[model samples]
Target: MRACHALLAATLAVAVLLVPVGAATTAGAPAVQQTPTPQVDDGAPPDRPVEVLTLADDDANRSATRETTLDVGPAVGAATDAAGHELRTIRALARVRGADDPDAALSREFDRIGARAAGLGRQQRSALQAFADGEADARTTLLVLARVDRAARALENRRERVVTTARGEGATVPSERSVALARELGVYTGPVRSQVAAALSGAEPPARVYVSTTPRGVTLAALTESGYVRETYRGDLRRVDDASLTRSAARDAVAAAYPSLWRVRSAVDVDPARVSTVRMTYDGGELAATVGSRNRRVFRDAHRQSLGVAGTDRQAVNTRDGFRLVVNRSYAGGPMRIQLRTVDGDPVAADLTIGPEGGESSPVGTTGPDGERWLLTPDERFTLVAIRGNTVVFITMDPLAAPRTERP
Candidate 1:
């Protein structure tokens, strides 16, 4: 009896030692404890709401403008206008057709333009840098910019002609990368061009230039010594109404292209055939500006316009941490402007890091008091990580992604 009792005591001690910590033994069976799974919140909405807003009839004609000041001269103005005209011509040529080995032809043209534009871009940057360093005057810098713009525009025009001709001959369409490169070559100088034109015509260019768009068209305006000098292009307004060439048809077309917008606002007059002289309010001016920019390339293939290369591209997203992030890229591989703000629209200063998705990240810079930073974008898709205190937000940045037509 003593021997048996000793053996039982030894077995019990071994059993207790074998059991895992926090595990329970019931009826001589060990019960394993399970760890609860962790939950992760990515901050994206379960169903992202489409972002589009349309204005009421009373506000449809209104314009929203952003103003800036820059020195201008006659020579610079003429050169700027000439560059703008060349870019416009390139856009037109993209609608035309071409013949024989168009792809090969396009590739050669692209190489030529690429080489020339790169040299000009470098020159422009050097001149601008000199001006920034106070080594060059504003007039001199503007002249250099104008010259570069003119040369770049001509190169782009030549490339577009090749693309158009090849496309007509049933050659493969140019890639988005090529189109983006071309667009970068002919940066939008609308505001500068207008001011320069005013100076060229022997008028004192306004100290403040306002760039705006309305249902009527894109307008560049300023309060000059003489009066308010305004230049408007009705092309976009007309294009918006060209879907079926009728008011109702145009409304339906706008609805189809921008369904989210159609759901909200009352239909406005879209009669392309008649002159609309009604003075409109600027209810959704930013939205109008976005749509106007898009309208310029409506006739082109949907793929090219997807990049939003025709104008400034803006996108906004809400962070999981109750912040709003806005990114603006005028063209692919161009300077990207990043803005961080609270949900209430107050700017937030935060450190920003960027890298390829699922890859190592590097710190770029922090936003300033204005909650904005500008950086050159890479040609590939990447991710932006914004950190403010314990709050961290991740946003995927696809430089080639289609831009949303919503106001940011």
Candidate 2:
């Protein structure tokens, strides 16, 4: 019986030793294994192992041993249970220490996230503040500019209205408006410009085309205070307002006739001064004097007999103080005497010729055989000229091609 009891005891111990520690029973309930958590600490947590602590004595008799058998926990469980109060104390300590291990780390992560969020918020706030400041500055600048603009507009509105009148736009002198401006600016002029301006002021706003002529050329003035209408020119020979028109006519007429001619320097009209004296005389009591411009020419003819053949004894004559005389005769060659005379009857004889199919002669005096004397040259082509009633003659020619006749 003792031997059987011992064997049975040994078997029971072996069975107990085979039980798992993780499934140790407490109050008849299985121990539950929870998922492990990593505990952050200075040292690693202690690991518990499943253990077998067995006393299998085959020689021991149950009756002699006074067997009071208790079904303890598994081997590692029993050892842990034997130290249960201490294990409880250790677990409580571990629980308390676990806070120290991971608490700082959790705090650090949270603090990191909070700091990042705070920095982002500060950046956003700064951007918004800068935008608001820029808007304020722009509004202030716009207000100042608006005030300046209003002031400028007010000044423009306060500016005075100006009314002025002027007569001659084409005149050399200043217009009425111009005069006012000049006076305002403190300027002065001589008698001519002042007189002209004053005279113009009395007239209508648009000036009339007044004509005046002198020995040199004609003048045509175009005047206006009004903006509209083309200017007019006063002219008999040609339009004088345009210097080009005058020049064209002059170049066409005078340049071909006189080699000594040159273009006038100024386009403005001017008059030529009179020559001192011009006299034509002959051996007899006959004289013709012309005092004026150089364009005057004189022609003379002296014939002893009236008729010899159809045309005979004709001479072409020229006077020194500018005169051209021609003798037209039917005869091809003829003997003739020609002379230029002073008012006191002194003769300057000239070259004589005759080939009269009626050619042209220059502007001057001419006498026909009928004793008819023409002092002034005809403006058109001439057929005949002759000395008339024995009154001497003086011709004054002006540069504007005007003829002034006087009897001597």
Candidate 3:
């Protein structure tokens, strides 16, 4: 009977061990798994497997042999359950952070635009005041005003684009009040910019002319379309403000330097120690000359003329110092030709030398009746000196082909 009772007790323990730890008991409570103590052959306890409720790492939690249940309290001052209240708070904070991030970015962007607008406003005001004060000539003032107009237009366009993009992206941009004020400011500035453009239209002249004050005298230069200094005069300024005198000087210099630029406008740069000079540059050649005051003598033979005939690769001519000479290089390694003619197209027979200065003079060549003759040399950079009855002209030849004109 005792053996039968012992066998029945063993069966009951086996049934309890077979029950799942996650299962509910008859009292509707979770069954906790109790860890059994480990045994060792040497009579010492071994390390048992520990079941931990991990605060991090979902994989460990998913693989846990025992289940864990937590009952947290409600959020502070809230009536809802703790989990639900905490979840709602988390969602609300996430939304607030999301909105704040873009809002902060928008604020920074608009602030920069606002600063640019303020600076542009100051520039516009100063420009207007300068126009009223006649601080510079009409052309200079108009040029400055035109630049301001362009800058303002650019800013206005960018502001419009920013507002449109922000609206499209559902972003919180500048406030309605700020936008309205900006629009009002735009309205005020529009007419001002337009007025400036109109004033420029009436007051603007040809390419800018500059008169700069120097330590030695005064300088007058015409700004070319490509921003080059078309220096017209550099000489003593008996009267720094003498427009007539400067105009005359410019006329004389133009006549001597670029006869074709007769209608050129003038800008003055005044200096005392600066040397005054004039230059006319062509594609393959350049001519330069030193000049003095308005009373300075002009070169009588300073006529503009072509150097090479039609269809030549390189041609250059200088009609200054009472002479005319044109050198034409037909092709590389081909015989370079010298063509001398007067402004009237009469052939000028002259002896020509081609080489570097102070170097051995190349074989002399004389022009034919047609003012064309070949010099035996490679197409390269070398000085050409032509002499005829006590008259000498020196010209440097560049092999590259570029067509340009400068005058006496």
Candidates 1 and 2 compared: the better one by TM-score is 1
**Model 2, range 139-221, lDDT digits (tens) per residue?**
22222222222222222221111111001111122233222222211101111112223233332331222111111111112
Positional deviation of residue 296's Cα in model 1 after best superposition, in angstroms:
23
Q: In model 2, where is the ten-residue run with the lowest total lDDT?
A: 8-17
Please give, for residues 1-408, the per-residue lDDT of candidate 1 as tens digits.
Answer: 011100110100000011333445688544422212212232221122222222111212322122223434545566566777577456545533332455665666666667777787567546544643446654455445445555665666677676667676777865654645554454423334445444544454424333322222223334333332333333323232222233443344445554454455443433232221111112232122112222422111011111222224444334433566676532222345688888788999988887765577877668888998765444244667667775555555444332233321
Query: Over all chains combined, what TM-score does candidate 2 have?
Result: 0.14
The pairs that clash in candidate 1 are 61-280, 62-280, 62-281, 62-282, 97-168, 98-165, 98-168, 98-169
Compare candidates 2 and 3 on TM-score and give the better one: 3
- By descending TM-score, how would the candidates be arranged? 1, 3, 2
Q: In model 3, where do residues sit more than 4 Å from their true spots?
A: 1-100, 184-188, 191-408
Per-model tally of clashing residue pairs = 8, 22, 28
User: What C-alpha lDDT do the candidate models reach, one value each?
Assistant: 0.43, 0.22, 0.36
Worst 10 residues of 1 by lDDT: 7-16
TM-score of each: 0.32, 0.14, 0.23
